[model samples]
Target: MTDTTSTETAVRTGLFIGGEPRQTDETLTIVDPAKPGVIVGEAASASKQDVADAIAAADAAFPAWSALSATERATLMAEAIAGIADERDTDAAVLSQENGKIRFEGFIDALVFEIRWNLALMLADEVDTGKTLPVVPGIPVTTEVSYQPLGVVTVIVPFNWPIAILAAALPHALLAGNTAIVKPPPSAPLATTRIVQRVAEKLPPGVLNVVTGRDENMAELIQSPDVAKVCFTGSVNGGKRIMEMAAKTLTRVTLELGGNDAAVFLEDAVIDDVHLDRLFAAIYDSTGQICMNAKRVYVHRSRMDELVAGLEARLNRVVLGYGLDEGTTMGPLHQPAQKAFVEDIIQEAKDAGADVREYGTLPGGDLAGGNFLRPALVVDPDPSLRVVTQEQFGPVIPILPFDTEEEAVAAANDTWSGLCGSVWTADVEAAQRVGSQLVCGYVWVNDHGATRLDLRAPFGGMKQSGIGREQGIEGIRAFQDTRSIATIDPEALAAMAH
Candidate 1:
């Protein structure tokens, strides 16, 4: 039980814990990346003890929540989805204010779609009863396999897509009958907490909770022993550290880590002016903040010049600014460290003999107070440069020209991460063949980043991207413990003994 009235400020801000709003004196200032002096709002910073208390509350309520029939749980989850839908515009506005994404084209629609899709995923499979089996010449035996929830799920959402990452873990956890504790990324905490508060009100006490804080203190909340499972979305290094910490209690983890995805453009691919424009959008959308962002492009040496020219022209037109501004195409990186890191990568790539050509420009000088790094394009003199190999999570595109189809495949699969990739070709058969050859969890053919992710399909990485799947039936199964039940009737046992 929470005091909803206490958490609501004049700004309509609140934290949800145990199905109600919670307030605290500890303040976390939300910063807008584009405008340095513009403070979005202040969010309550939850202490380690607050996190622990939430976990304990979840633990206390787990038995009742997890024992609910699947249908019953799904019904509640449906209502939660409707609640989220009702608050869509409000959620999008705050998300844009905090994270600096263009609300209309980028964050708003995607967040709504992600939540809606997750809800559809929740209702994909119904509760199945035990199947009747023949027992010893016409007698019937019963065997059953049904999904069960883990006790309490703790979802740690990253800054890039606060609502989407929360949706990735929240709906599934609740529909599978698990209580949840959501810790939004520090930079954009208020928007996510507000979203959680809205949805949590419709749930039972202890069924949902939201906490906000700085990065160093965030780990303490995640590694707490009271949490039964954790679903984290962030960088690979951060995911590794979380895994190490979670090892103390052997908490079940679903980590959606970073990616160095390859977009292979084959010789047979037809790249007209229109398709090239769309391809550039696919690569640089959200200022290349997505984990599946196309960091590297492999085009046939024959068409390298054409591809570069087309990409350069289209990228030059992106309108960059704060998310609140109308017609803003690109937004600033949400934090100072991110801007610094991207700038470093761009400079390093140039230093390594790559031809650096930037489409967008940062108006403020370095150390400009706000985090802003514009879109950059790099044409590598040496195809095997570090810029082409590493995962630079920014709007920096590296174009590498390859000679043969085998070479293109080799270049794409050479990365240590295998999260997602794309292949563009007019020859459907060749494109399919190349896509199959790429070592990635998702392969988009003839396009990029538009591959449909069905809820029934398992979602995860093959190599260093991460371990285990998070969505689909496998996701629900990930939250369960299986036991093999064996029994023999007295007559069958006696016959076996004789």
Candidate 2:
């Protein structure tokens, strides 16, 4: 329910509650991250009452929406996908304003990664019914397995990769017969809200809803009696809070939280354009805000200097500015708070005697006031340093050289965040061997991120990275519960008992 009549102005937005655009007197102003002083727009500041209404709407719609055939559900998503293409340029611009980077890449990834994952989940209906195993013989007794949607689903999207994260929760929930309420991160809600508005308009009223508000609204949604499942993507601490709150209602939860993923380059690894380019992209993409980003680089002593030189040389070409700028390859951190957090980590690493080689130069004008920073590459930081041990979630990474296989494996696995990682080597066997030792959900051999994501593979973090999974059969199943049915013949049962 966006105002299509005016495209030039700061398009004031409202909460998409109960399938309609509902507004409140209190609204939060969103400013362009690239243009700090310029206002992007104002979005509804959803109060607790708004959240309760959204949950009620979703609860009311679940019975009918989830009862629809898989084909019908799939059609709704297909329509949304087509709408995405039509508004790609506009959404990209809006996305650029709300967040400093990833509008283009995020949009493309939604099409490539999101839609692909959506299609896989669409097949979940058939898979759930058609793929069940035959019951063992029990003299005329038959047993069947089936999947049922988990009613109302609450999706909390992170600001970093909003569209892609939405795809993970919303579409699957709808296609599997569940209704959903989405809470877009306020920091970068404009573009994400635009995308949600498109989907909400296409789908039946109450099937999908989006809200913008403070943290309390989310807690309310998670603890709502009607919400059956909650899918969240953000910080580990945030996930923990959600879990603790949801426990009261015993609502199901899936968390895709933070990561301190390491990229290990073997002694014989190729340091040429192919590997180095992908490696750099893995760490720098989204300004290193991605959950699966390579936060630590472990290289063999033999090739440490070469890798550093290559990374620094590539860093020279990076331009930090507005997302839409053709020459701008990097962008500012969306949140001002993140700037201080990242700075503290880097400064702490430096204090620990780490050799920090920083790159890129901040420019003036609109970019000067923006949250810009030269991406840092710290060398030989103490293993216990914050930069080395915790998830940076910013454009700063640490590189350390390892002497042996045991040292490299120990160093890579020495973290609570086990989201993902990579192993670089000429020998596939060698890479495979080492990748097996890394305690992560997925370990790439030569590259990283969405480029390496197998469409049907399950995506989730291991250990403290959080529980459950997203994507693949498991992903669709998360939105569903199973039922076992059996038909027993009385005569057969009596005969068997005799």
True-structure RMSD, every candidate: 3.8, 2.4
- Global lDDT for candidate 2? 0.81
Q: Which residue pairs clash within candidate 2?
A: 66-177
- Residue lDDT tens for model 1, 1-498: 111211122233555666656777787887667767666677877776666678887888789988887778777766765645655556666777677666764345446445544554555455323243435643333344444667888888788776765665577777677888888887777667776776777778888888776666566556777777888888899889889988988988888888898888888778898678667876776677878777899999888988998988877887766666666778777777877878987887778777898877554542255566778788855666656777877788888889999999988898889888889898888978998999988778767752234435566676878776766556666666554344556676566666
TM-score of 2: 0.94
Least accurate 10 contiguous residues by lDDT in model 2:
1-10
What are the lDDT scores of the predictions, listed in order? 0.72, 0.81
List runs of model 1 lying over 4 Å from the truth.
1-12, 105-110, 113-118, 121-124, 127-143, 216-220, 363-369, 450-456, 491-495
How far residue 179's Cα lies from its native spot in candidate 2, in Å, is: 0.4
How many Å off is the CA of 452 in candidate 2?
A: 3.0
